[model samples]
Target: MIQGFVKTPEVQALLDRASGKTVEGGDDRLKAITRDLVESLMATIVKYDVTESEFWSSIKFFQDGAREFGLIVPGLGLEHFMDLYMDAKDKEAGQSGGTPRTIEGPLYVEGAPLVEGDVDLSDDPDETGTLYMTGQIKGPEGESPDGAILHVWHANSQGFYSHFDPTGAQTPFNNRRRIKIGSDGRYSFHSKMPNGYSVPPGGSTETLLKAIGRHGNRPAHVHFFVEAPGYRALTTQINFGDDPFAKDDFAFATREGLLPVPQRQGDSAYVAFDFELQRSASSDDEVFSARSRAAA
Candidate 1:
């Protein structure tokens, strides 16, 4: 084993300089986080005795696959970890009992048309498999949250999402909708049954998964962003329990209460589920995060 030198004064000085610890002006939070990150990376390199070639190869992998980082991050469980971390923080702060948050994979597009009451999300005439989903949003005490908005989106039958489908087959906002809930806090939508999909074949996400001896596949699921005036906004999704990948989601988004089995009703599939939202602690909690989202 190579002698570990990351803890030595020489390496410490280098890290401090590299992380801007010696700088006079900068974002303090960023600088501190950077220092910790660089220190950990240096320690890992020393611990693993990583060679220069191996390091550069890893860097080149990221450089080549930068576009797929959104998929890659969730596949690596970083996004799921964020959810888990947030849950723990909430629990520590005495916040409890609500729908579990999960990974909001990087496919959400803003500006979907908002409609009151039940809406039909299926726009393709050629699609045949029909799915009807209905749900109610309630506060922690089982009271309906008045004036809630349910933003929903899902992939098409071919697992291609609108605005990002490489085939150019999907129209704008296909399989996407925003339903307005009244005093009853109920919403519903009808859409085509979405198929489970795998990561882009031979792309960066798939290549990395292959290298790690893992398959990149996600189960059929519907994404939701629910918000109310006095309730904390929720970013969650529900996986079809019957999907083969329901328990083995590559994005690590499958949660215990989020998996709802679909019931067959003649030619269509029906799903009934309910969401519970915690009361907002502040105004900020009543809105979704400010992450960059696609708009069209």
Candidate 2:
């Protein structure tokens, strides 16, 4: 009998059972991740002479990583898979027109200030840059989806989002809102154009990106989450016409149809856009989305 370490057949059997049960997600990807994780652990076990402290430390590290993984696939661009699937569905259903969809970032809170077709969101005296966003929410048949709601948000001119910036003032909990589309399916808003920004330099996401020598920079853009009864909620952004980061956004959220066409109009330049919605008979609940619910 071994003195400190257990060597009994019962202990060996328990270890085997535990190892076999580590992956239970039933999804193919989960199984693959489990296989890779176990292989990685086995390599470390062989390298460091397999001790309780080393094994537990590695387990804790992985547990933290898993805990921080928000369920939103858009956070990692897996939502691109969803985009492709939805595109196929649209074509199959003969749904045509409106705006193509894109990824919604995690910073959108909820319940942003509601206004008519336009609003001034800057609310800062020194806020530089002008943004006039004009668009329409229309059905696939090109009919106005009157009263459709547009929930919008964006980074400040400095690229700092509310709630996330400790040094900066916090806006309402959700930098989001419900806007009623006009009879012509048109909507618009006013805010300072946002600047590009990096992810916090050393968070888990940044650490991994820098390890691969990748730069973290999301382009200047306005985020929108549009919903109309019968239409699928569209989570997307409109890229600033001339932002250098538009093509090289770290999040890869910029889409071909999402770049707003800049138009000079007197004292202000306007970004014109038009969005098409999938039609159906559903309530606002089916269409409207808060931040938590959107990510969930």
lDDT of each: 0.90, 0.66
**Which model scores highest in TM-score?**
1
lDDT of 1 by residue, 103-205 (tens): 8899999999999867988777546679899878999989998889899999988899999999998889889888889888777888888888999998999
Q: How do the residues 1-296 of candidate 2 rate in per-residue lDDT, one tens digit apiece?
A: 23323335664455445455444545666555655565565555656577889778756755765633442234456666667787798789786566787766667666566677566666654346577877678877788775678887777767787766645674543234567776888887776666778776556666556766777777777788887766767777888657787888767677788876567564356787888777654564256444453321
State the displacement of the C-alpha of residue 219, model 2, in Å, after optimal TM-score superposition.
Answer: 0.4
Residue 276 in candidate 1 has what lDDT?
97
Task: Write down the worst ten-residue block by lDDT for model 1.
Answer: 120-129
- lDDT for model 2, please: 0.66
Task: List clash counts for every candidate, in order.
Answer: 0, 5
Q: What is the C-alpha RMSD of each candidate to the true structure, in Å?
A: 1.2, 7.1
